[model samples]
Target: MADTGELKQLPLKSLHEAAGAKFGGFAGWSMPLTYPAGVMKEHLHCRDAAGLFDISHMKLFAVSGPGAAAALARACPIDPRALPIGQAKYTFFLDENGGILDDLIVTRTGEERFIVVANAGNADADEAQLRAVASAFDCTVEPLDRVFLALQGPAAAQVAADAGIDGADLVFMQGKETDDGWFISRSGYTGEDGFEIALPAGVARAVAERLIGDERVEWVGLAARDSLRLEAGLCLHGQDITSETNPVDAGLLWAIPKGLRSGGDFIGASALEKAISDGPARKRVGLKPEGRQPVRAGAALVDGDGNAVGMVTSGGFGPSFGSPVAMGYVSVEAKEKPILAEVRGNRLPLQIHPLPFQPHRQRKG
Candidate 1:
């Protein structure tokens, strides 16, 4: 239980409760922690079948009017001007000091319209910054209250298509706004072929229920989401990536386009330029634990001589890999080799590995 008061419930709270979802507090939202099938089973289900997740707690902000894309590019490093219509890019909102404010998925919905899906905990801050930027332009920034859901797994697309949703033709990282007021995107946190839909409030439940009626779909919860994302090597905002972290140190250099990295009018351009020239002393890396015992977040990572170096940012049992997988910042010196994670005063070996502990099965066009 979190010390925070007044945990809000999702629009699908009643639906989740009826399906026996375990409860927990996530960003002031009383969200599902797990379900009757358990986290492990749900995790596997997302790999083999499809798992439905209520992600309405996450914010959806609309930025549009005129020159919206170029207007937004000032704060976000990614060139929204270059993002094609119907395509989405995973990028971060950087502060003036080059620190990551919040990572978000911004999808270009139209000629001048865009929708940003931000992390739940950082939604308020994200919108505030976006509003600050919009005040200088001819655009508007409005937060949305739609019900967001993730249909994740190998069978996610087929099931959603079978249910009459608009996802079968969409490629990875693509979305199209429907006349029914829902935006369907073929992307997910888990490294799988999936779709995330943002639906109107009135039809959210009906759409979700219809999809789950298929034999390939099941209700999942936050626990499975955490493990699935960890296996996918995706960073969890406020954890693996923080306000103090920069994209260079976070191993997300790929998100920075070549032209942007060298010179751009982006918010964090100056500081990121320095980081790129001097090189970040540390980098995010993946670790494979030697045994079945799981390494958890914040576990102390040490060097061979027991000197503290870094800490585990995300760690868990990878059901697909059938091994414990962990990821964290390690000194560049130890990044290419094995290291140790101190758990309960016992140092456990963590072999250095590349990301995506579970292979991604994106259905790219």
Candidate 2:
């Protein structure tokens, strides 16, 4: 276990404490698990209003040089050279055997410049991987000096406009660096119409204060954040995806377009291309438990004879759905075969459905 004292804190740590946040360790950061209102309220508030999340633990990296785009294509499955400026893409870094090392959002800033926002825990390794790719091209990959925050919900745009950010016009998957140097992306993990703000640490607090002061905005912690993403049927990186799994198993083949320029010949591309055509042995799916207790990650998915068929990746009581929802990898045969989830050795009937237990509110524009 990592030492609590060694955990880093968000730039708004003092503010979070002032707001009565209960802190916990996440990806080596001392982040809030919830505020005084608690996880349930925080989750619901993000569905009805706007909830502010201090995601500064996430790392921002800038890649640029004459061959940056081509270099990126060689490192990942996507062809960054064909990406339009301001466009954002969700992609994964893989090992030579087609296992997911990390998944990140890459935003094209120019013809040869891009910014990749990586998950907190994988930041160091992600940097090393990007640098490894850099050796093959004339590019520089380095962390950006910015604090990242996520503002999500139905009223998210209004809250941003009310705070004088003037970024309500941007739609999903688009990002722009403001004249003030704040990078705002019209995207979020909650599957809502929202924005992720990357700003200078010095000024982030002021903007956060301005937004939090609004009636529609309040501090939400990682606990609620997890439930929100689970309800939306989104993957939570370390849990749902890892170096042991490939994109095909996680239902992320769409991120790597085979027909387009594709994740061609990149690291795991050989195996991935074959897996894409043959289909994975198992795929991620949603599960609706038959009883009250919610199944959690690592719970076994079992067959009629109590043989393990798969394992749960994420599970919890979805505040919005008013029931328990979970995601797991089940045998492709289990898609047609009746299965049960072993909960504390007791068998609970499982109903398989397509991903995203709840509706995705993310705007296509």
Best by lDDT: 1
Mind sharing the TM-score for model 1? 0.97
Per-residue lDDT of candidate 2, residues 100-205 (tens digit): 9999999997777898999999999999999999889998997887888899999998889878886776889988776676788888999888999999988988
- Pairs that collide, model 2: 77-263
Question: How many clashes (backbone atoms < 3 Å, residues ≥3 apart in a chain or on different chains) does model 1 have?
Answer: 0
What would the per-residue lDDT of candidate 1 be over residues 181-236, giving only the tens digit for each residue?
88889999899999999999899989988987888999889999999999999999
Among all candidates shown, the one with the greatest TM-score: 1
After TM-score superposition, what is the CA distance of residue 323 in candidate 1 from its true location, in Å?
A: 1.3
Distance from true location, Cα of 264 in model 1, Å: 1.4
TM-score of 2: 0.97
Q: After superposition, how far is residue 358 of candidate 1 from its true place, in Å?
A: 0.6
Badly placed stretches (over 4 Å) of model 1 are 1-5, 336-338
